[model samples]
Target: MWQHLSSLRARLSLLLVAAGMVGGLILAGVTHWPLPQLLAWLHGGMGQDAAAPTPVTATATTAASVPMSPQDLYVVLAVGLVLLVLAAIWLAGRALDPVSRLLRALEGAVASYRDGDFSFSIAANRRDELGKLIRMHNELGHTLREQRQHLAQRELLLDTVVQNTPVALVLTDASGRVAYANIASRHLFNEGRSLAGLDFAELLAEAPQVLRQAVESGEDALLTVDMDGSDETFHLSQRAFRLQGRPHRLHSFRRMTRELSRQEVATWKRVIRVISHELNNSLAPISSLAHSGAELARRGDVDRLPGVFATIGERARHLHGFIAGYASFAKLPAPRPVAVEWAGFLEGLSLHCRYRLASAAPERAGWFDAAQIEQVLINLIKNAHEAGGPDDEVTLSIHDGGNETRVEVSDRGPGMSETVLAQALLPFYSTKRAGTGLGLALAREIIEAHGGRVLLANREGGGLRVTLLLPTAKAPPRG
Candidate 1:
């Protein structure tokens, strides 16, 4: 019965009633305390005489003669009223004690909620309003738990999508600060540090215009960011949206380097097609003219025929050289590697290029091929020598790097420009005055066939450095 009233509303109601009763008692005492004294004084002032007469008169006279004091009467009445009020107050407090306890429990539940503890519950077995309240509290807790679980699942799904998405994705806030970055985005941008809270513009300094436009328009924007110090391209896309009632932007990046490479290859193929058609047309007529001139010369028709033959021969030789260069580009044979002692091969190459090597600085030595490798070395050395001035020197160094061997040919010449370096391996792309540009192209083709890579870079001090890396041959088993 006591526990039935133990609720916030019940406790509040009890407290209000107790306060009102106390206030009313205090007010009544203040107003009525002096009334009894004033009434006694008024009765005394009425001047009624008292005398001892007969038997009835004697009893009245005796009661009148033994007069009661106003102070004593007031004290008696006040003490009785005080005792009654104390008993009522004690009973009321006892009745309200359960309510006070229930209020405390409710307060504890609210405090736990404030502290982020959502698992607390209140017990109520009574069939009253307090029981209904407890049931509601339990229901509220269940709803909160379900909501929390749903939120957690949503976050997990978002994480999985971000990690598995093929395209890179980065999310930022209204202030352009990075909020989240997917795994693909981090890999594509080469971002090692945590992306959260980083300024988007600072991260994408390579292409700030895209970020700026996205922020300004609050919409999706597409742009390209060219990777520095590499032959890679990235396609960037920025999108804006609201998340959890706050505006955010997402930036996506995809590597488009392969696409660009395909486009360059297509362009080269078209150029090759046009050159082949023109060269064939020009070569046919020149070959026929040269044959006719040779016939005239054979008939012993003297002076005019001799001059014509010379002219025909010169034109035919030029055409022949042109055709040969074209054929070399057209017929690039695939590589076939065979094991050979690389050290002895390089030594033979040095001897073969003895004239150029004698003039060059002392060669740096290691291990590489003899015939095929020598061909690559010879081409590079010739190009280096041609590029270097008479007083300038060309240097060749061999490096054995455990798993692979490298041959470096460096020259103290004016370094190649960016355009030249980019297109050096392209057929017919030459910087020389009277040279066929198929040398580097053929050298590259041969090196690639041998499972090697050729790299060209400008030297720090001056000139260019060409590095050739070849895999080392595995040793045979012991006999």
Candidate 2:
């Protein structure tokens, strides 16, 4: 019952009832004792005065005016008090009605917000604290609604992009079930059928062997597959991340055939231009020299003939060497693998290039084309020496991975810019005035011929680091 009376309305009703009871008791007491005694005293004093003789009619009138007994008056007062309390309670209920309604509205609005329906608001029509609270609630609702609208629009835009993008995107849950697949992925894997809830492995069951192998490897790879009798290349990228405290994976496949074709055309154009320019450079000087030599012969200037022949021969040799470089690049042969001790290989390389050993050479033997690898290292070390760093700071390190050998040459010099690093291995790309641009390109070709790769990156603090990753066993070289 006390808990029931805890509310404002119940407490107010109780206070009103208590005030009425106190007032009724005080009225009953005064009317029953002090009021009647005072009247009797006044009447007695009037009768005792000799000059002011009371009329018999006046006394009768006064007796008549005393209407009821004290008992009857008490009853009437109690009934009045009861009626007043009932009226007060009714008034209190009316006064608190608006507040009760406001409380209910607030509850519903909160529930709506919790349910992600931010469109609910309370009406405010007063200039009091309660009204102020209602206005604030409305403002909060408005803010939430605006935020929700903006969020929905953003989500729609993102979904549209993801759905329409050309790259095939697939998202898988921890159990390897396909949770989401975009339009491209659906078309590529299942003839435009939805891929949700399907096994990811089953999707690859009918895929080309190259793609399956690449995906199974769980690493970024570029693969070529024969589709409809034509070869197409794709680059696959995979990433794993946690979503809502659960693991998920994203796989992306981007077709690179068209892009690679464009790049190939551009590379051949560059090669042609370089060859033509070199040919013009060497032929122009030789043509003038030949004309001068013929003039001397016609004049019988025998003494200058030998000097002219020497210059002509030198020019011929330069032209021959330039053509030979291109021919060697075009006709690079497969690498002949051989087991070579790292110590002996490093000793042999040290004879041709100067470098500081950054770490001890791996004791394990390396399996690759020894002569080709030596040439690649020689070219890289030469580049480092000429890279304008301190000669002593040029460093070489070797790591013996279980299945691969890594050889790194680092130099403390100005590192390559992003653009230079990107195309550094492309044929005929050079920065030097007299560079043939064949050294790094030839090195890349040789290493790739040995079924290896060349990686270039800017080292921390300064300079460039070139890494050659070669297989540790005798793997047949790629043609």
Candidate 3:
């Protein structure tokens, strides 16, 4: 029964009943009993000595007919009201004690949640509104705990990936202190020691000269470092970003020596195969033609001898050209940069291979090896013409950007696919059966020698565009 009445509503109802009963008893005493007898009864009921004599033999009608004086009525009424108010206050405090404690618990739980602690939960012992509220708070705590666990797991997985990756990653704060460093970075910079909280500049000061130079440059670069008597190549990249309203920088170093070695081996193998195939094509025919010519000479057939000899000569010339192509690529010389005028250079290039001027030629002179650049343009223009486009549609445009010259050779023809475009600049890689594949590769070698770059892209609608970016002449100079 106590458990059932533990709720605030039940406790309050019982309090109301008790107050009503007390009020009823007081009213009966004041209306039916005389004032003297009433006071005597009140004093006797309170376990105190009666100040007035008790009317033991008095009749019930006489006691009922006695009227209470105004002063006596006021005293009785005042005492009754005071007693009632005290009883109500005591009952209210008893009924609301648990509620005050529950409110304090809720405030404490909220504070815990704000502090990112989700382990605390309120006990839900009753089934009242406050009890239901406690259960909901517990549920909220449970949900928050689950989400926090999932987030923690995700962060751990991310840390594992970053730590185990082969690329060395380092993050530095705006004050040049190391904020984070992965396992690879630790090994690379500190011989497997932790790098956190160290000065980034101090760490770099102890690093290899090549690595120090690359980092100091603040530019993405490929550098080679001699380590344990073996040269290792690494590509370094740096990026700056804001985190938590503060600037930070991330530096990543990826070792590229192994990848480069693999590519070099593959390139050598391809070169050997191409050379063997070209040699067999030329030598096999030449041998057959020589045997045929000898057989005709044995029969005194001189007319066919000349034809066979001419065929052999043509095969020899083709073989010579093929061999020379490889030799030129292998022995590419350093560029001799010189001042070059646009009109004269373009005219000379046009004489070798035709192209329409798509944009007005720039007036400023460019700095590069004119002979080498002319050869590259000739090869490109010839390719544009042979791309199955109309001869007139082979267009060349030159733009004079601030510090560089952009020469674009575009053709309206079927463009190269992604796969083809990717490997087109590689030596001995070609789509045409008769192509030596040295044209584009040699062009790249020459342009790079001139401190320039070659870019290839498909034109918007249909066709290909080859852009050559060359440094412009800052002043007139000779090779």
Candidate 4:
């Protein structure tokens, strides 16, 4: 209690009491005089007669009879001091009210900053020191909010670039742990798996040496990597810099496989078109001459004309077959679908193309242009036979794929290499010297036209497998 007596509240109370005493003294001094005497003094200053002393004498005699004691004066002073003390307390609370409100606002702003929120700000309207302090804090909050917004925009732009770009990007920390990976990185390097916190070395396990050298050196390096059993080349770019005061690496991988494949296919198509045009121009005259010579020989010249006609006829037939192969591939017709039973279709396929059936046909039927699909199957079966030995039997199987029917033709031939299979369906890409490379291409075009797909790959048992996927004839189940 004694310690608190010297506190601000206590000191303020004492000062209030002291002020009351000083005010009491001033009031006492002014009021203790006879009222009549004071009134007469005022009248005397107004030029009234000396007879005004009569009222002063009466008032003086009355005050003399009721003179106040020291104790009475002390009582009045004490009462005035108590009123002043109460007034001081009321005034003190009013003054401290604003302080409490300002303190709360300050505390809230500080907490918001700690929580990474800079949107809240204090509004100070008063022209005082505390108001000035609030305005300064509000300025700081505004600056922080602007900075937060700027940073968010930058982060959004970076994520968009990283995820949407065709190039694969991998970001790592100083210790080579993966910190960030873009969508392409997940696809090409991680097989669509999470890359965060994974070791950089493990993420690039497919081409560890290539990636390591690229990361260590601050330069772009072009390298070829084996992906999906094919050698795919990529242009790699690397840069090392500090992020948030820590060293980091950004590695970019751009694939060149599609671009190179496009260029190669474009060149081949141009060459094939040129050769086909020139051959057609020369074939018409040769066919006409051969037919004229054959007619002449059949008419009468039977000595050397018989052998000449036979040679010309043989050459013309070969030429016709060669030209027909190119023309049929180049001028494929759209599918005109007709419902065909699987059993009859397989019988026709076997009789025409000599493909031995390996698996029994499923009960389901197929809907496709019989002629176009037959051509697809015949080409596949013929290629299978030609690719294999004379005794090797090409096997045919049918798989009911619910939505699509899969017809697989397997041959026990020397299987194509990884590189060859990748380009097998490309036009003018063939293993055989005499092949126009149009068989697989035409098959693909026909299958795709029917809203189906064609896939060619090596079979598991050392042979080539050609799969033709066509839409099934069966209706879909109602949802």
List, residue by residue over 1-479, the lDDT tens digit for candidate 4: 76567344566577667666766654554446443344435545554454454555555544324444565456546655665566667656755776789999989989999999999888767555566778898999999999999999999998898798899899999999989998998887777898899898765566557666765677897778766678888898888899999999998889988998898789677657746754665576567767777787778656766666666566667667767877877677767777788899888876787767878888866788888888888888888888864434688888888888888988888989999889888776677855667789888888888878888888776788899888875333111
Descending-lDDT candidate ranking: 3, 2, 4, 1
The lDDT per prediction is 0.67, 0.85, 0.87, 0.76
Q: Would you list the rank order by TM-score, best first?
A: 3, 2, 4, 1
Can you write out model 2's per-residue Cα lDDT over 206-254, one digit (the tens) per residue?
Answer: 9998998998999999999998899999999999999999999999999
lDDT against true structure, model 3: 0.87
What clash count does candidate 2 reach?
A: 0
Encode model 3's per-residue lDDT on 182-300: one tens digit a residue.
99999998999999999999998988888998998999999999888999999999999999999999999999999999999999999898889899999999999999999999999
Residue 76 lDDT in candidate 4: 46
Candidate 3, residue 410: how far the Cα is off, in Å: 1.2
Which should have the higher TM-score, number 3 or number 4?
Answer: 3
Lowest lDDT block of 10, candidate 2: 60-69
Winner by lDDT between candidate 4 and candidate 3: 3
- Highest TM-score: give the candidate number: 3
Residue pairs whose backbone atoms clash in candidate 4: none
List the pairs of residues colliding in candidate 2: none
Off by over 4 Å in 3: 1-110, 118-147, 473-479
Worst 10 residues of 3 by lDDT: 58-67
Give Cα distance to truth, residue 45, candidate 4, Å.
80
Candidate 2's C-alpha lDDT?
0.85
Per-residue lDDT for 416 in model 1?
Answer: 92
lDDT of 1 by residue, 87-204 (tens): 5687577766766767888899889888877787888675556667778887887788788789899999988987888777888888988788877766654454567787877766
